[model samples]
Target: MTDQQSKLLKGKQILVTGGAGFIGSNLCEVLLNQHVKVVCLDNFSTGKRINIEPFLQNQNFKLVEGDIRHLEDCKKACLNIDYVLHEAALGSVPRSINDPITTNDVNVSGFLNMLVAARDAGVKRFVYAASSSTYGDHEALPKVEDTIGKPLSPYAITKYVNELYADIFHTTYNFDTIGLRYFNVFGKRQDPNGAYAAVIPKFVQQFIDHESPIINGDGSYSRDFTYIANVVQMNINALTTENKDALNTVYNVAYGDRTTLLELATLLKTYLSEFDASIKTIEIKHRENRVGDIPHSLASIEKAKRLLDYNPQYNISAGLKEAVVWYWEHLK
Candidate 1:
């Protein structure tokens, strides 16, 4: 943890919704290490209990098994919490496309419940897991905060609605909130087992198994593939920033760099080959790009830097090296 983060969150009580999930579990681990009290709320729908099982015994870490779709559950999790890290949401465009209603119930309604609960509980700050999917059809090189095009998928719509609702909460109820628009975040504990799993972990697992990893497109599609640690840093920064200009706004949480699918695959293959030389022979296949897929994504993280004093420590290569080691040790 950074000195600033330690100073701000040392003794505070924090509530991490979806704490059994990838990003949430990472946050809980960091907070516990910082000697802060952490309350974790998870439904385990997409989150695995194993991700948080190690922290269950930590006295500073408390787990509350519940769904975010319920108001009572949101209220129960918010009780006596100093801050809220709202990361519980049904992610993936394909998943949302398949079942928009369920996605809406979890991402939209659940988010509203969290906001209302946080308002009533008088939490100091509410930082949430917003998405780069909110960028939608905007054909820009580097996405900025204020500029956004129409949402292409139900998932994108739900995340955009979150930003709208968050702004309203601050204006109407004077609640403090920060939205961190994340790019393609990946790292340890990120589940690669599901159909809706992100590319990095999924591809890494396939390579480790010496199976052909399929690329959705011609492998030209690119993204600002952020490291999980950088994301954790952004969340901590959002929660702790004392700058008045930083409050009640959103910031792009990313490494401010992009990598193509082909490049990513090659990198993963190269990294994994160190563990098993056979992985170097793994073939990569290409297929049609899925519906609602964007061709390229990059983030201009200037807003985060200016407002929150954000400094991302890992670029793609550095983060990928660490992630590869974790996946090898755990998944292999």
Candidate 2:
């Protein structure tokens, strides 16, 4: 950790919206470790306070209970913030399909409010969480930044809109911004309690608890699952890079590899079930394909490699090992 701390975001004040969710919490910890002063704004919609509890006593860290949908909340959170790592959003495609208005309100309107607040706060940079789902219905093997299909779900539309707005902010208001188009991100702190929980954490918890994990659409679907550490590195690079080409551009933050669902389940069960042999023999129940769900998704990360200087440290197998171990110890 100390060796990696050389690129410490030492003098920066970063405001991480939704800083208590899985990815957000992990990002907060990483920033704090790098000696950054972090202001975490969360309304606890999907984020849990427990995730930020460890950093409460750290002078470099401050927590604000607030909603991004409210302009006042955003204004207050962005006060004196040097950079904004915007991660607040309603994430699940199925959930968005079930309640699109709420997704649009929180993701679209809430995101705009944050952007306005960040602009008003005089922040130097705006780094946001963009999604690979923006490539919805493209039917491509590895998605590139320039090509995207019409959004297949409300969630996808909201994320794509985020990129569009970020671009507008750069050209219209001269707001220097960068976007990291995240693929299937899964690692520690990803909540396994909700109906909309991500597949990796949900599967790990079920395997640990000796419950049969469910596989949707015969488990043939594939994804380019990215680890949180790689994402944190990308964010750090985006925040610091003074390269003229990198600013105001979107880059894919991913492992540049793909894995099928059956392959993923086997890896999770085998890795997690090592703690207890009984979990090794668990069965999987097949379910109907989910609505607004893409069969396969991948990212062409060469742009990030060339511009962001992003070198991902963990591939799918390495990432799963750490994630499984974390869930086994913490979630148990």
Candidate 3:
């Protein structure tokens, strides 16, 4: 944890929705390390209990198994919470393309529920997990937060709606909120066994099994590829920042760098080969880019730096090396 983060969060009570999921669990871990009281709310739809199992024994960590889609559950989770880190939402554009209704219900309606509950509970801050998918069809290279294009996927629409609702909550009800529009986040405890799993974990798992990992396009598509620790830092910064200018606004949470799909695959292969040399021979395949897939995406994190004092510690190479080692030790 950073020095400023420790000063702001220590001994405070926090609610982390989706705390059994990858990003949420990491937030819980860091908050607990700061000696902050943590209440974890998760439905386990996509979240795995194993991700949070280690924290179960910590006295500062409390678990509330509930869905964010339920207003009652949201209210219950927000009780006595000093801050709310809302991360409970259905992810993946492809999954949303298959079932838009469920995605909308959880991402939009559920987000509203948390906002209302937090507002009523008088929570100090509500920091949420937004997405780079909100950039949609905009052909910009490095995405800026204020200039967004029309949403192209159901998932994008839902996430974009979250920003809208958050703004309203601030303007109308004076509820404080911050949205972190994350790029391709990957690291320890991220699920590698789902149909909608992010590329890094999925590819790492495949290479560990000596199977060919498929790229969604000709491998030219690129992403910001943020590390989980950097994301945790952003959430903490958002929750802790006293800058009035940073409140009720969205900032891009990324490494300020981009990596092509081919480059990502090669790096993963090289790192994993350190554990098992056979991984060096694993073939990387290619496929047609899926519908609603952005050809390229990156982020300008200058806003976060200026307002939240956000300093991302890991680039792709440094983060990938750490992630590869964790997967080898835990999954292999």
Candidate 4:
């Protein structure tokens, strides 16, 4: 953070809903490092307590055990909060296909609840966790903010609804907001055990165990595969930017590059081999493509660069090497 940006957020009270999740907890850590007061609200549904356990002892960090689906919980968390980094959402296409009702309830309805609460509480800025899935079926190489295709899954629908609600909130109530459509974010603390776990970490773990990690398709599908640090930087930029034009719009938050699944798997195997030579020999398996999945995803981060002065520091290889090291240390 620059001196000017640090001064902008020095002592401000910020609310991070879903602060116990992967991206949220990382945000909380950064804010606390800057001596900002952070209020974390989570129901421990998808969020793990261990994620935010270290922050429990910080004098400036407050944890509110609550759900965003409930209006009262949203309102309470917004009180005296200068900014809201809304990262709470039910993610994953397959999970949404299996149980879309709960996904809608938590993502769409819960997002509305957060917006209402933040607007009513007079929060300055409401920055949220949007998704690259919103660009579903667009068939575009690098996705721009304005152009989007039909949602491919319940999860995508909920995320698109979030963008709609945010725009409406800004137009109707004059609420200042920014939505970050994140690409395949991964890093330390990203859970690798679940059925819906992200590809990078899951593959890393499987390689460590010398197990064949199944590729959903023929491994040709690619992704932007953003790092958690890059994501955290974008959120901080959205929260602290003084540019008036930067508000009330969405931006694609990504590394501005793409990596194929086979390339990604090969990279993982190579990185993991430094720790365990056997991992390099582990065969990679393939299966039929899953439903609601797009063949490729890339993002144009120029809007963010021009508006928020965003500059991502880590690319795929640099970020993956670091993530692999973390998993080796902790999950080994």
Candidate 3, 11: how far from true, in Å?
A: 2.4
Assess the local accuracy of residue 227 in candidate 3 as a C-alpha lDDT between 0 and 100: 96
RMSD of candidate 3 to the truth, in angstroms, is 0.8
Candidate 4 ranges with C-alpha deviation above 4 Å: none
List, residue by residue over 263-318, the lDDT tens digit for candidate 2: 99998888876888888789988898898999998889999989978899999999
Q: Whole-model lDDT for model 4 versus the true structure? A: 0.94
Model 3, 68-94: lDDT tens digits are: 889999999999999999999999999
What TM-score does model 3 achieve against the real structure?
0.99
User: Once model 1 is optimally superposed onto the true structure by TM-score, how far is the C-alpha of residue 121 displaced, in angstroms?
Assistant: 0.6
User: What is the lDDT of every predicted structure here?
Assistant: 0.94, 0.90, 0.93, 0.94
Each prediction's RMSD over C-alphas, in Å, is 0.8, 1.5, 0.8, 0.7
Clashes of each: 0, 0, 0, 0
Q: Show the colliding residue pairs in model 1.
A: none
Q: Write the per-residue lDDT of candidate 4 for residues 127-198, one digit (tens) a residue.
A: 999999999889978999999998999999999999999999989999999999999999988989888998
The TM-score, computed over Cα atoms with residue i paired to residue i, of candidate 1 is 0.99
For model 2 the TM-score comes to 0.97
| Residue 224 error, candidate 1, Å | 0.5
